[model samples]
Target chain A: MSGVRVLVGTRKGAFVLASDGKRERWDVTGPHFGGWEIFHLKASPADPNRVYASQGTSWFGQLIQRSDDGGKTWEPVGNKFVYDGVPGTHLWYDGTPHPWEFARVWHLEPSPTDPDTVYAGVEDAALFRTTDGGQTWHELPGLRTHESASSWAPGAGGMCLHTILQDPSRSERLFVAISSAGTFRTDDAGKSWRPVNRGLRSEQIPNPTAEVGHCVHRIAMHPSRPGVLFMQKHWDVMRSDDAGESWQEVSGNLPSDFGFPIDVHAHEPDTIYVVPIKSDSEHYPPEGKLRLYRSRTGGHEWEALTNGLPQRDCYVNVLRDAMAVDALDPCGVYFGTTGGQVYASADGGDRWTPIVRDLPAVLSVEVQALP
Target chain B: MIRVVLPAHLRKLAHVDGEVTLDVEGLVTQRSLLDALEARYPMLRGTIRDHVSQQRRPFVRFFACEQDVSHDAPDAPLPAAVATGDEPFLVVGAMAGG
Candidate 1:
């Protein structure tokens, strides 16, 4: 029998929500690593039993947690993340030279074929890889040493390398997105990188179409169609057909395209989803109604899916990493909100239900479809 | 035996119910005590201080016998009561962030 295990990271600790393929009832476990901020949790595709978590605190620093038997038990692996070389400086919000610092791991991308190999995207904007599971980490310096890195500035959320996309068809190609500093692509694994923000326009920056200063909230791509990328920027929904060589606005009919999370249907390559928040300043839903807008044509045309979602008096924000999808037949979409609700739609986006009503403010949600 | 009390979160991480007792081989100072503590509970490394710089974390503090010893040098000797196990050396999370 197939099942789904939703790994949820929250402001305080982590939780594991499990259910059979029916996706009806769920068993919730944890508050694991209690009082600690779990920024991201993901299971390896190479091994369903292998899972990794990024746990950290402002006072105590970062810690990596790994589990061999899913999320049932986790042990702290490695907490050290040091930059290579002298660690050059990047531009501060004030355009002054600021030294790069290790803040926290924002996302963890495990290898598709090796459970022991994992990649971590972290704040101060850098990528680190651990080939020996999570036991050690070494910085991939090329991304940070790009020619324009000196001008890269931090966004409101601090300069974080939040999004990482590995090309399923090509092992050498990888894409990463940073706040304020646009998207970057590495065709030679981690040895080299280049800015891929050719058509992304950000009014917030001095130069609206600068090569590397867009506040891209999230980016998603279906594994089968690795070249087609969809992004939810600070103000627009975008699509790239040429693997991010260029992008175009796809904010067709969304009430507001200024949202965080954006994900694609597991089985439908042309189907995508976004939770449109009011605006960057106003982090709540437009009209105080929670609605998930879906695009069947990839973008430009969208429909609102709000059957079981709150229609009024609800004002929670969905973060960039809070939404995910399971690779089941009918396809299941899940997302968590700042108001501490984890909503699951077993049948695509037609209807929704809360798997866990209250938890710590959710930071990220990832799902593992197990056999 | 030197008695040390970790912050609530660190205690849960180390899986200790209350204060932890450690045997400091040499001088009883912040540096030596922490060395012993981390040697015993490896998971506590980098929590109280930087893993490389060894500088105390900005939001973490130290106190012994009700006196704030956070500003003391790492090599400075702790109070007699703390060294004698009569008083526990406290690692506190500063009252910051809501």
Candidate 2:
């Protein structure tokens, strides 16, 4: 029987929500590594049973956990993430240069073909790779050591490399998104990188369209159309069709474009989803109504999908990594909110239901469809 | 047997209950006891101390005989009460965070 597993990372810990193909009646097993913050959890596409989690606490520093039995059991692996060379420095919030420091892992991207290979996007804006199934990690320093890196500054939420995307058709091509540093691409693997923020404009910075220094919240792409990318910037919704060589504004009619998470539909290459928050500073639904906007035509034309979401008195915010889509036949959409609710829709985004509630504030959500 | 009391979170990570007892082969100092502790509970390596510096974590404190031994030298000999197992060496997660 086919099933779906939703790996949720929360402010407090981690939770694994499971269900059969029916897409109802979820079994929640959770609070794993309780009292500790679970930043992200992901399963390998090559081996679904193999999983990776970024577990850490303010006092204990960072630790990586690996599960071979599909989240039923886990073992601690290597957690040491040291930057290469001297690490140098980057611009601070006050325009003063500050040394790069390791804060936490913000996202985990597992290899599409190797369960033992994974990429960790970490705070202070650096990328680390683990090929020995989380036992050890080495920094892919090209992104951080770029010529423009010294001017990179932290966003409101620390300088973080929060997104990692690999080209489905090109094994050597990869993309990474960093807060306040814009997006970068590596065509020759991790050895070299270039800033691809030419079309991205951020008024918050001195130069609206500088080479870097854009606060990009999140970026998503459809596996079938890897060249086309959709992004939820700090204040705008954008689309890039030239493999991130350039981008264009597609915010269109969203009640507000200052939101976090952005995800593409499983089957529809042109369909994408975004939860528009009131503003970057406000961080809540508009008029206390929670709505998930859907763009069937990829960005410009969008429709509000609020059939089962809160219509009033809702103030929760969805994070950049809190939304995901399962590869089931009907294509399930899942997202977690700061209010500790994980909502799921079986028939795309038509209707929704909360699978589990009263969890810690959700940080990220990733789903896997079992065959 | 040198008795050690880990904080709640460390206790959970090490998967031990109550107090953890270890056999320190040499003079019991902060360095010696920590060496045995990490040897016994490998997962606790970088929790109480740093991985490279081996310095006690800022928010982690050490107490022995009701004294704040967190400032004590790593190689300095521990109090006789802790060495003799009369009082367990305490590892506390400093009063911090929400």
Candidate 3:
């Protein structure tokens, strides 16, 4: 019988939750690097046994931990993430030029074909790649050195490169998203990048339709259909049919479009998920109800999946990296909340169950469906 | 043997129960002691200080003979007591941000 491993990163540590394909009766493992903040944990698609974790703290700084035996054992790897050259400057919150500084690793994306190759999206917003499996990291440099980089400012959460997507159909194509600096795509494998935010509009910035200042919260692409990308912006849930060349608003009929953590279904290319918070200012669910909205036809139509979720007085928020889906038969959906709950739905989003009720406010959730 | 006391988190990370002892070949100083400690426990490299700049992290401090020597030069020799192992050199995580 196959099983699914849910790798969860929380403010305190990392946890591994394992369950058979039945999706019931889980065995929980960690608090792995206890007392440290684990921003993200991901299993390599080519090698499930190789798991990478981004562990750090404000005082202790950043450390990357890798587990070779499927989260059973781990060792600290390289933590050095110096920029490619003399790090120049990007726009500060006050519109003043500020030197680029390394803050923390926000996301880790392992190569789809090689376990030893991984990409890291970091705060202060830059992309770094490691070829010898987390042993060393070098900045990609092209994305940060774009002409518009000087005008890229930090979002409310600090300027962070939070989303990384490698095109499954094209080896040379890759996409990365940065908060306060829209989406960027590299067709020649990080050699050069171009901003792909033609249709994104943010009222907070002076130029609502500027080429690079929109705060994109998250972007998700189904592995089977890499060209169709879905994004949950700071204020709208969007969809791009031509690989982010242009995006159209799909927030139609949802209670509130201001939300984070958008994801695609395991088997269905047109199906997607998003948690609609009340608004940007109110980071909780609308009307105190926790709902996981699912759109079977991509977007413009959605239904609330709230059978086992809290429906009243629940004010916790779901972060951009907190939602994930396992490619198990019948499709298993998982998400973590700020109130320290990890919920799983065995049969798509029809129902829900909490795998672990209390943890240190989950930051990211990734699932691996084993054969 | 030079005695060094690491912060609680570092101690946990290094999996050491108490003060760690290392053999320092040259005159015991903050830089030399930390170099030996990180060499012995490779995981603790960037925790105490930066990997590139090698500057003491803002919240990390050094103490010997109950004196704050964090601002002191990294190459400065330690107090006699610490050098002689009579008083263990302490690496403290400053009491700020919870």
Candidate 4:
């Protein structure tokens, strides 16, 4: 048994699912981060011992937690996020707090360039940055709900910051996706912001702009290519060659157009993965089928991988942070669903296998290949 | 009399589809309505509240007149819309990221 660590963030708490790299013999660990809802969990690729999670509490508010011992123990990134020694007010609409952060984190990612740098997207569609290994935090400015804060609105779950992509080579280059509120980019270290969602779409606004409710769910950047990016829109999967300044539909060949999260292979940039559910009306897996689609050459063509997956109807949707690929040999792919099921692929998603079943409704899935 | 609306998933579990009417005195609290619901449909006992603490599960959300009442205390008196039977007390399961 080789060491393969799987971290799952759920509506209840965060759990660590450890495997021997065989996907057969696995052990599950506690509700780390306590009663807080965890939206995102990440195990460092540079240092497997360093793990990070975005978590929210019903009464404690939104916060980030980090673990040096994988998922065994954790501490808050910052006692409280401060700006100029003062905490910034939370972003909310109509007095009610953002619905997504009811009690969980929606996204947490560490900068690929600097291991100490961390980013978290919370329920109020706010983005927070940590540079001292999560010891202290600063709220990024100019990326709030914009002019249409109330009108843009949160979906049923209530939108928030869900995507954070940092360029591996440049710490200044970062992207944040605001569900129901398109995408925003900062190249000058958060001093200013601009809408990068040129081709994204939204139903509420007839002629959409990049600053409106484009509702971007997930964003994946090609490891080596700084400008090339891929995103899972609320309605379709899209790609951008100019770092989100523009996009094009890459979901023509998939089983269904509707989906949530999207991921790109670390080494093979063109290799991407997405779980397609039925669109707006049906909202289930395509034809009540759960299959992960792998695109070898961008989204031009997709191959459904289901060698060992369930052939029955699975309407459970996969969240944006739930599907991830380990930067291991042959590349290990993993995803958890609302059905409390986790599926893994050791050979680059060519085949699939269930690792855990009937846990809590999974909110996110993270993997760390321990040496 | 209080009318409670069960979401599709919960409706299937309650067996008798659509809204259910309940009669309660004093205030229409979540605890009182839930008790009435469980008394009428025993199968729905543990579905909405914990069998012991009677706490709501993660997904099940309570709403009255479009406002989320999930976080409200169980003993809190419900809105007039629900208490007077003019509107249904909705037990909606929040659908979110998996």
Residues A1-371, candidate 4, lDDT per residue (tens digit)? Answer: 25789999887788898877666667888777545578778866666778888765343345566888877877655535332222234335454433222233477787665668777776556677778887776677556533444444565566677888887778787888876777888888676677788887665555664356687878888778879899888788899999888899899789787788899886898998988988765656886678889899988699988788776867787877888777667788999999888888888987887888876778899887778
Interface RMSD of each: 0.7, 1.1, 0.8, 13.2
Residue A186 displacement (Å), model 2:
0.5
Give me the displacement of residue A76 in model 2, in angstroms. Answer: 0.7
* Candidate 2 deviant stretches above 4 angstroms: none
Ranking by DockQ: 3, 1, 2, 4
How high is the TM-score of chain A in model 2?
A: 0.99
Q: What is the lDDT for A189 in model 3?
A: 97
lDDT of 3 at A196: 97
Q: Lowest-scoring 10 consecutive residues by lDDT in candidate 2 chain A?
A: A196-205
Off by over 4 Å in 4: A21-24, A33-35, A77-104, A145-151, A209-211, B1-98
Best-to-worst ranking by TM-score = 3, 1, 2, 4
Shift of residue A210 alpha carbon in model 2, Å? 0.8
Q: Tens-digit lDDT track for model 3 on A1-371?
A: 39999999999999999999999989999999998999999999999999999999877899999999889999889999999898899999888999999999999999989999999999999999999999999999999999999889999999999999999999999999999899999999999999999899898888999999999999999989999999999999999999999999999889999998999999998999999998888899999999999999999999999999999999999999999999888999999999999999999999999999999999999999987
Interface RMSD of 4: 13.2
lDDT of model 3 at residue A182? 92
Candidate 4 Cα lDDT to native:
0.75
Reference-based lDDT, each prediction = 0.94, 0.94, 0.94, 0.75
lDDT of 1 by residue, B1-98 (tens): 89999999999888898999999987899999999999999988888999888999999999999999999999999999999999999999999977
Tens digits of lDDT, candidate 1, A170-193: 999999999979889999998999
The C-alpha RMSD of each candidate to the native structure, in angstroms, is 1.1, 1.2, 1.0, 11.6
